[model samples]
Target: MDKASVDYTLYLVTDSTMIPANKTFLDQVSQAIDNGVTLVQLREKSLLTLDFINRAKETLQLCRKKGIPLIINDRVDVALAVDADGVHVGQDDMPATLVRKLIGPDKILGLSCGIPLEMEKAIEEGVVDYVGFGAMFPTKTKKDIKLDRFGQGPIGIRRLLRTLEKHNSSSERKIKCVAIGGINQSNAAKVLYQLNTPTQKVDGLAVVSCIMAAPDAAKATKDLIQIIHTPAPWTQALTITKEEPQSLENKIKTVTAKSPLVHHITNGVVKNFSANVTLAIGASPIMSEFGDEYEEFASTIDNICLVLNIGTPSPEMMNLFKHALQTYNKYGRMILLDPVACGATQARLNVVKELLNYGQVNVIKGNIGEISGILKLTSTYKQANGNEEEVLMKGVDSIAQLNEDDIISTGKQVSKDFKVVVVISGPINYVIHQDRYKSIPGGHPLMGTVTGTGCSLGSTIGSFIGAQADGRNKDKFDVYEAVIGAVELYNKAGREAAEEAKGSGTFMVKFIDKLFENTHNI
Candidate 1:
């Protein structure tokens, strides 16, 4: 179950819309195969046995043709019906040990272990090939119940490693842990990367809704698998902005002067600081919530941008984000969402899910966890073992494991997934839009230990977009350029000030120094 040789990458499970029910059925299956999914799970929830058999036959054929492995979820009968590649059972969904006995070896066998007890039972049973654990986060279809600790988030890479350690003594089939729950393009690598021990790490991701829901399902599937299948050194820590050096510089200066006014429906922790950062960078800042003035406000303002955070979530605030988004659409305003602490809690992440339905966001900023929740990475929506104890969250910040590449990729993926600019801000700020990637590697390390840097970055972006809306600047100050520019200015300041500052107390002074320099004197 270690991270070294896990097979969890590129795992896909077909749980909904079975067997070419429509003309696109086979096309979808073909696309999944084309996307590089290494394994497929046929999860037939409500189909009649005969209908299920027929679909399984077709799926098995398609999978075999592609040379991809196939597993049937919760149905040992189906596994034998089509001589499917494998069978996945749950705590109550036919014991894997028994299914193994019935199906015999050579074929694969999978078990779903939602908790430690279930894991022990599955392990004791011993016939299982690999174990599946989750509804790791929260899902409507998964029937999230109140149990001791049935549902949780990514549980940090360290804890996931530990959990794998606990179960290492089990089967020699190389126990594989897969982090499921809303794993998306932005954060898939983060989850996989966190699984430190190759022997103990989960195999790959298991996504459902995301790949199925995209406008271009095939492209989405292909992209997700392409990135997943890509082995390490992993896309380098950061990539580049193809705008060319002159173009990039011009875009930055032009955007700052244009002065966009960004709207933030984000955390209270950095409200004031975020606004200040925006103003400091020569962009106007507007912090508004959902209210009678939402649409009205969006309409009145030409350069409108939106940001949503989960740090200090309130129902009132949540409602405000909804209204603001409504207003954003009415005005065709550009918006950005920060899925902060997204996978941390059901309530916190629900806001992100709801917001996804509303189109018109120009960017999304988040850490790895938030991004994973947004995408629902692979076939299963579950995390590996032992994470709750290790994954840390105080407010909305990422205080767990370190994954620079995954963080950077999360930003790049935001651009790809939503067709918007993505910013992953931390000790270093990564502004990724489209295929081009750029890293602003200047921020002080202390920035990570602080509170408002992230919120401030989002607000900074909003301000830049607002300025662009004034019609005074060239189109060069697009979202892509704005993000890079913001990171450069923000980090340059942090690093410069860190040279003279000793602690957080002096950090404020140096931050101001850097911010002031970047905004005016620079």
Candidate 2:
């Protein structure tokens, strides 16, 4: 098979050890191909050399007949012996340079890479056609898995893709990328979607048990292909349009009319203010940290939105937050995550990462320091000094200094990385969604004097996004526009309230009043 005539999407890596009792391995492979598996990898780690070569030749016949490439995993000799389409080698396997020389330029060459440096060396040698990134989640298939190198999940994969992009900038050929290890129907969509960015994306997914071990491989393959082709509900709903955005008054009118139920699993200090802000925006608020009620709240409620604040990120609270997040994700409900004081403590950073991986988040709102912290979570992020500067915090407030340009760029990167709307709270607030971004430059100095204004802004966003969930506004639901509307309303209200307030105490009251007046005026 020619290397150029390869489709890397939906790669099936065979593992007969896990195959079902009644199922023959070849039948399953054929079934997967009959459905939509575009590539195949024969990976029998324990089979004898003769047995391995025999299996490779048989699989090659099936693959060639189906017009799909068959890759021999970690066995260049077997691949050459059977004249297979490709050989996929791991970091510990024989050198790729030798493998390429043996296979020649016409056949495909794949590599299993977990680190940027490993990929860097491969790109330097110019001996690889594609790379497999992961061991993304925990799996029983590979027992000797190195958790340190392999379990970094999408964070690790993102770093690897950035490395490929860095090389692609000057290289003649763009290398293909495929994510492997523990991918299944449950996570394939999130994995592919989360790993994709505006600049780069994973070319395909490689799986073992999802297709190979299934009792009916065709149905399994069809389900996975369907998921890959269909956009996730939230992702589909948030697609940016070329037309002009709706008027701010009309956006606020949707919120008041729908009054989305904003569920706040937030900190102790901000509960009252967050709820008051929710009410002021004409949304119902339910402040519940009780983990037991999360299912009913997420599954039963209509026109619901979840606002997750990491202010009180105790171990127990984090568990509850994750449960609520997953429940909301299961129902395809909207979520707004406030990583409060995320850069201030290691514990908070850990919690934010956990929440990010646990479920799909529609929006992430934070200050410049917190957003900078989120940017640092990606291994490739670097500042001008080529060192990650610490985000200093006094109590829950960030003393980390970042200019406006830095804030906008940081917000943009975070939005791209997490696949969520990013709102960076600053003097000039910035809201970013995919390729679209807006800079809203209004808000009074007194807004900084308040304690829960930032947290309450999350509540406001929850209200607007909740309205987007309403069937009444189904034709008008645009999360990017809704988030833009929320930030502008909050900032403008802060400016108006600051004009009428005597001090911080009165500014807080007037801010709520302004939210009510402004939202109701529509």
Stretches > 4 Å off in candidate 1: 1-8, 16-27, 120-125, 144-150, 156-161, 165-173, 181-201, 209-217, 229-312, 316-522
Clashes of each: 41, 0
Compared with the true structure, the alpha-carbon lDDT of candidate 1 equals: 0.62
lDDT of each residue in 300-419, candidate 2, tens digit only: 776788999988778788778878876787667889999988888766777787778667899999887788778877645742335454755656677778777777777777887787
lDDT of 2: 0.83
Model 2 worst lDDT run, 10 consecutive residues: 143-152
Q: Clash number for model 2? A: 0
TM-scores of all candidate predictions against the true structure: 0.51, 0.88
lDDT of 1 by residue, 163-218 (tens): 55666855354566566666766555544543434346667778876665555667
Candidate 2 ranges with C-alpha deviation above 4 Å: 142-151, 288-302, 314-332, 378-380, 383-385, 434-451, 469-476, 492-511
Please give the distance, in angstroms, between residue 478's alpha carbon in candidate 1 and its true position after superposition. 24
